[model samples]
Target: MRESASWLAPGRVNLIGEHTDYNDGFVLPLAIEFGCRATVSPGPEGMLRFTSAQEPDPVEVPVADLAPGAVPGWAAYPAGVLWALGVDLPGLTVAVDSDVPLGAGLSSSAALTCSVGGAANDLLELGLSPRELVAATRKAENDFVGAPTGGMDQLASMLGEAGSVLFCDMRTLDVRPVPFGLDAEGLALLVVDSRAPHRHADGEYAARRRSCEQAASTLGLRALRDVVDLDEALAKLAAEPDGEVLVKRARHIVTENARVTDVVALLDAGKVREIGPALTASHASMRDDFEITVPEVDVLVEALLAAGAYGARMTGGGFGGCVIALLDQNAVDDAARAAVAAATAHGFATPRTFTTSPAAGAHSVGAHHAG
Candidate 1:
């Protein structure tokens, strides 16, 4: 029997695609260095215990009483994973510590859940593949936490590789690691946390998802990814009531999918800097078409570009969250200062900024066996 074990999973940032995942479109995301770690070991009979470095209090629940809504708040994420796994097991104690910022649109929730799930899978000797873990963690977020999100975050956290970005086809669940040698190119990916709260469970995100589904159903397609001719599709949608909004939503998805492909091609050709325009264009679409970006995010994106970022855009599910800017490594500090200055000038919350490259996926960090 395993006496104890620990696992780690990283948060992610989308370089291009946004609001396209649920539409079965493509996304390019990279797991960041910051993430969550979970340590697990046997516990008292019939009881599951959880503790977090971030939270002062410890939470304990009965193994048989684990269910959605049974555990609440931060503890719910780990408890949800246990519920979704549905495996008979002895009571366990799980301890977690994380540096991934909450409400930063960086997949903190996914990292938290995946870390716990990965630890449980290994400690119990359950031979679940990475894809299976992705499914289990995603189910925990969707069914247990009540967040309406696609599997991109979980998949990225599970499959990420060092020095590579994940190119995911949401429809096929196919993922490939694309080389992203930013340091070699004298470039950096600057992440500016706007400090504005972004919540996926909120009505705004669900509403955008509903709009996409409505458009797909009206177009007689499985998802927005099936739209072959954007012009024709938009024209057809324009004839319906509230067609204007649907046209914009569909346009963003179709064009964003194309942008993902273009960015991938540029990366393949080693034209890393050229992808900046596409990143900026993505933010425009999210702001104008999807109506997801808030003033703080919008201002930061603009400031990044003005301060010489090659390209900048808001990442993750956005009502407000983080913005990523790709630029020269030498210019990173200046760009960060400019973004913070812009936010403060606009009377918005002071933004936090950091730089990171692609990082490794979830894995076991340590373990011990019972004698």
Candidate 2:
């Protein structure tokens, strides 16, 4: 390891629990092996410099006060991490590279942000715990990048393990790792990229969050996590029909929360084979009820399922992006091939496919700064 070195902040796949985080709900996410790798080194000028494998040039920023929507393009993610890090630790230099596709419904920005934060923590010996890293990265995204994303992605990227799914409570920040080593059983988690991207700053994503807040406030609860199901919530909403926005928001949160709990219980019981149905249900709910899934994503999921996937559905914030499916290992290649052919036949751009496995959380892979 050099005086400074690189760290891997991997992207996450949410098994279930969509659009429920802002409502203080539970989420099941597993960090995938693919993500941003930040190679960092100390700078004599007390400046932060960053470059990405996907970018044309390195973007540089000062180690002082950072602003929201400050730097443009991919640079803002790592730059924002550095700015957020500086609030706790003063200065450093960083360079980032990533395989995680940006805005492809994978938490690429969160990975880069956490990778930079992890590398900076090692370089500065900030002694921040993994939990602290999660908090810092979330702060960076919210305050610096101006994306009001929940902590699920950042937490999964920071606390992931190679063979486990993370069951996290967004309200309490408590995480329990659930083993998902189904590869030996001839089952694999496949991600099919729909090639459609979602923008977090767009009005649609923000509107959903605002709706959740409105619902929580109206219900006299801190968040929707306090509730159990949508039917009970609907009855309350019917008492005040004017609260239609709150009703819709509460519906998504409550139903999604139940889905998360059920999926986790199934995983715990070694019922990996039973998860496909839940996955399909989640996608449909996010699409028809939540109104997040776009046409491209819906088509992709349908194509995958039609091709004999155990279950398939769109993952991420939804306007357009990736779909994940559970498939028999032997059927993976066929499933992927059929998805590509179907996309082409439907006049949609071909999608890429990759096998996903749980990955470890953020850790120091390089030598610490000399004391």
Candidate 3:
């Protein structure tokens, strides 16, 4: 086995679709420059050690003891990968460092797991394909971390290309890269971290998923993506008791899926500016129908729109997180200032803002050996 190696995986931002992945629908997401790195090296026999720069304590566990819910906190993410791989190997130590902000609506968890997953695949010569790695990392999250997220984040981290957004079809597991050259068009994509302590491994996110499943079952369809005649579907849902709630949930998924297709077409036609209305409409769906956006995120979106952003919406799993705004390249500063001022006036924490472009996906950065 190699003495040591390190791998890097970037966080991702969903430009349009939200809550559509789990329904086997479409999503448009791009990898961001900020990411996590995992370095793997030999450790004591029969034991695994995991450490993170962002965490206060390192965790050590026996290889046999690695199981779902056995390792807790941030360490579980990396440790879960070892469990999911279901392979026998030597003791190892993984040290991770990252610039991706936690709880900021960026896929920090995916970055962590994918980095570790890539490192393990290389160090062990596992020869796992990118799709298999995506499965392993997502399994680590869904079955181990107990987060009911779809494979969109992991796919984006694994298959992303620089200067493009990934158009993912969750049903078929197909991905195509669509060019997103905002700079060439004198445009900018701004991300505002509301710092509202976004947490998705909770009942709220699960509840939304359950609602979608229930709606799909009621329609006798495989998934919400099969809902072609949305008006008819809503009418059927609205007739049932407490169906109004399901109606709203189902509506968001159908419309959000369409919005993703719309944005992709706009980007394809090189009319990037026209995608603004779709972005705003997406945020409204999440706010009114999906009921995911927190007040601070709502304030930020409104502020950005008021400041002349072409489009703005809350990204990520959404109880609280960041807002992505598309606007003129020169308007970034003014829009950010407006968003922060609006959020703070509502007694919310001051938000952090930055501009980002599409970036490369996970790959090996370096390898080393003991002297």
Error of 2 at 33 (Å): 1.4
What is the number of backbone collisions in each predicted candidate, taken in the order shown? Answer: 0, 4, 0
Instruction: Name the runs in model 3 displaced over 4 angstroms.
Output: 199-201, 369-371
Clashing pairs in 2: 160-360, 160-361, 161-359, 162-358
lDDT of 2 by residue, 1-371 (tens): 23786788899988888888877889999998888888777764656676777778877766554566768877777777766665543345677778887668789888888988888777676778888888888988888878889899998999988888999898898999997877866899889888865644379988888777766766677888887555777777756755766676678778788888898998888888888888898888887667888777788788779878778888887787889999999889988998888778878877889989898877666665445
The collision pairs in model 1 are none
Q: Clash pairs of candidate 3?
A: none
lDDT by residue for model 1 over 169-223, one digit each (tens)? 9989999999999999999999999998664438888889999999999999999
| All candidates: TM-score | 0.98, 0.93, 0.98
Q: Model-by-model lDDT, in order?
A: 0.93, 0.80, 0.93
Candidate 3 residue-wise lDDT, 1-371, digit = tens: 78888999999999988999999999999999999999988899999999999888899999888889899788989998888887996899999999998888799998999999999998888999989999999999999988887999999998899999999999999999999998899999999999997655378888999999999999999999999899999999998787989999999999999999999999999999999999999999999999999899999999999999999999998889899999999999999999999988999999999999999999999887656
For candidate 1, the lDDT comes to: 0.93
